[model samples]
Target: MTGSASRPRAVLIAGPTASGKSALALSLAERAGGVVINADSMQVYADLRVLTARPTVEEEARAPHRLYGHVDGAADYSVAHWLEDARRVLAEAGGEGRLPILIGGTGLYFKALTQGLSPMPAIPPEVRERVRALDLDAPALHARLASVDPETAARLRPSDTQRLMRALEVFEATGRPLARWQAERTEPPVLPAEEAVRIFLATDRTALRTRIATRFHVMMEEGAMEEARALLARNLPADRTVLKAHGMPWFARHLAGGITLDEAIEGAILDTRHYAKRQDTWFRHQLKGWSAMTVEEAAGLLATMA
Candidate 1:
């Protein structure tokens, strides 16, 4: 990783959903004359703004924001795409002499910004279709991957269907395991850790759960269901990542009459809470050398940086 001798060029605020990341970023940007650059995967979609809990229009107007709701929902935006966009935004911030504050719950995005991502060989369309056509659940796919690329399979959860399939596809296309490619990182990190003030908000689990549930209710009040309906109306592919935005599938099921609205709300809340838990775990295990603190503590620390 590269190091910078000057003061920190950027601030990174990462945490679980409903952990006050957006609010804190906005406040810090306002104080520091910074640009708020999004690192959240879901919030990048223009289709599910409400469900993804993007900043309000008024809040966005308070500070310069970049990379929020910029991609079409039909597009399968990936970490590589986000990284490319972020590089440009970071460069612009540097040229304009503004502090760049990147805030989100997506651990992979943060990791990509700090430690460079590995470049995987592209899977041919035929290989991808074959993998997608296989009649197998996540566990079955994982078992299959274990037969071919046990090293990569051992690292992935059996329940992580998306990543499991990706690993399997890589194995099928290339003769090597996914792990081999990951061991050789060709893409350099955009913001090396030494150049940024990196923080992970460590909210109490109970408090975070309560906040997530409460915020889900607030999203409902803000027409998250309607947002889901509009996105659904576009009839995008079910595999599209945007369709899996928190509360989106539940709302779709509710709209389709397969579940009651109340049930959908409860399901979405449970899913979001579980996702928050996963976010916390990923940061703890995957990200290194980041200060872990409560939101209040983070605010104070970032205030000095601002």
Candidate 2:
């Protein structure tokens, strides 16, 4: 009774893609009076709804969902922005006395909730312009980043252009590498991990791979090709963030007669499965403190805690 006297009954349902997290969140919401909170990065973009797998029409109707696909596709949203939004939702839910179930596959968002996010400054335009001048070749950018932020560079795969650009931009803006800033900060989180029941609903890799493949096929059958083609005809920049949605370019090309539909489907499935693998590795290594449990187990734990 002493420990249960004051607990903010919140639930976090997170895992890799195709991990049945949405279903779990729905179930938890029904039983616990919780509203689902968006945690997926791609799902935050309004334009990539189908490609990003934002929850379906049925799912949204099942429970209240906050902050899904609410951002401009062109807008740059960081983990910090998401954390602020999450705090607002948490506050609202707490006031309403509704259970708050944060759900998605984004490990970084969960990390930000448990461990304080670093207060990194915005990159100055001059720094952005400088990095923009460098060729986009993977190795060249990787080398450039290595010269500035060796710690981040050492971990980045050569092909990680997004991260390489970010690392270099941070170094140029601050006149110091990102690694230095990260090493210096030691602030506690706004929410202690113990305050909420945390769960990472990892699925079996093989089963997840099959689910990814089947889902991609379903997507195509459900008009994904048309979706890509429509976006392409908008004449958005190939480098535009929306144009680069997962598997979008390939489907756009395939629809344009540059490749067979069969090849596009295969490529899309492969890319998603690979992404799932990376998510698995990240949650396993980086989230060492959060206790790992299946979705049901996590719900059970939360129930007993209350």
Best candidate per TM-score, number?
1
Error of 1 at 202 (Å): 0.3
TM-score of 1: 0.82
In Å, residue 24's CA in model 1 sits off its true spot by 1.0
Q: Can you list the residue pairs that collide in candidate 2?
A: none
TM-score of each: 0.82, 0.77
Q: Give the TM-score of candidate 2.
A: 0.77
- Looking at model 2, report the run of 10 residues with the lowest lDDT sum: 1-10
User: Distance from true position, residue 31, model 1, in Å?
Assistant: 0.8
Q: By lDDT, who's the top model here? A: 1
Question: Clashing residue pairs in candidate 1, if any?
Answer: none
lDDT of each prediction vs. the true structure? Answer: 0.83, 0.74
